[model samples]
Target: MREGKRLGRVIWAPVGAAVLSGLVIGAAARLLMRGIALAVGGLTGMSLAGTVGILVVFVVLALPAAVTATARPVIMHAGRWVTAALTGLMAARTGVSDAKIIVLADDGQLTPITVLIVAFAAIVVLHGRLAQYLTRRLRTLPESPAEVLPTPDARPV
Candidate 1:
């Protein structure tokens, strides 16, 4: 029983961390997508409601991608499932049935999946690089001695 409890504790911490990180990344991605949608909609003279719907659609599609791209493998796989479910719900709510949008092209023609693949690849690479940089920076910080450690005069005889 004790061993089982210990194992549960060890397992739960990483799972909890992954979930928390996924939620945070999802929210950040939603905000970023919302801002981008708002800017594009404004430039193209889309209606306010239309812009909001665009943002909603972006959030639905991008959140999971961002989380999966940035998170650990287990979380990444789970994020795909979560994304599919949310895409359905958001599509229903926003009246945007299709989640796929082709935005990039070459030779004056639209390239079906190339743009999306590149964008996701860029996002994943950027996220991974940023995480590595932050981890390296954190590792290089000097550790301070604990206050509980005995000083020369405080040492036991």
Candidate 2:
């Protein structure tokens, strides 16, 4: 009922933040890289459409881990920022490299950026699952019994 809805919100909120952060990171990275590419020459590996596609893919790749990681309150509130930043960096770097590799492949200069992306995505997904598992285990663990301490009175002394 209300608890379920509250739990849902807690889980979903970080996911929303991840989506937002992904979009922002992707757009910013694209803009910065585009500027650098243009400055070097008439070079631009990824088009606007490619940037959009990569951003979409990045969001998809990030969602699973984001969901699992958000299960913890501290992670949902604070750790999400760190996760977002790291994931964003990984996405941006991989996106740029992938685009460059695609351009190279077009000219018969093929490279394997897909493997890099796959590996990175796998790490993110696995890490999230591990965090969720650890949290669940901790929650299920029994607390140790407290020992009773006797107070000494003057008579006892």
- Clash tally, candidates in order: 0, 0
lDDT of 1 by residue, 66-113 (tens): 434435867665665565455445434432322222232233333323
Model 1 bad stretches (over 4 Å): 42-157
Task: Tell me the tens digit of each residue's lDDT in model 2 across 68-92.
Answer: 5535676543444455455556656
TM-score of each model, in listed order: 0.33, 0.43
The number of the candidate with the highest TM-score is 2
Query: Each candidate: what lDDT?
Result: 0.43, 0.51
Candidate 2: clashing pairs of residues = none
Candidate 1's displacement at residue 128, Å, is: 8.2
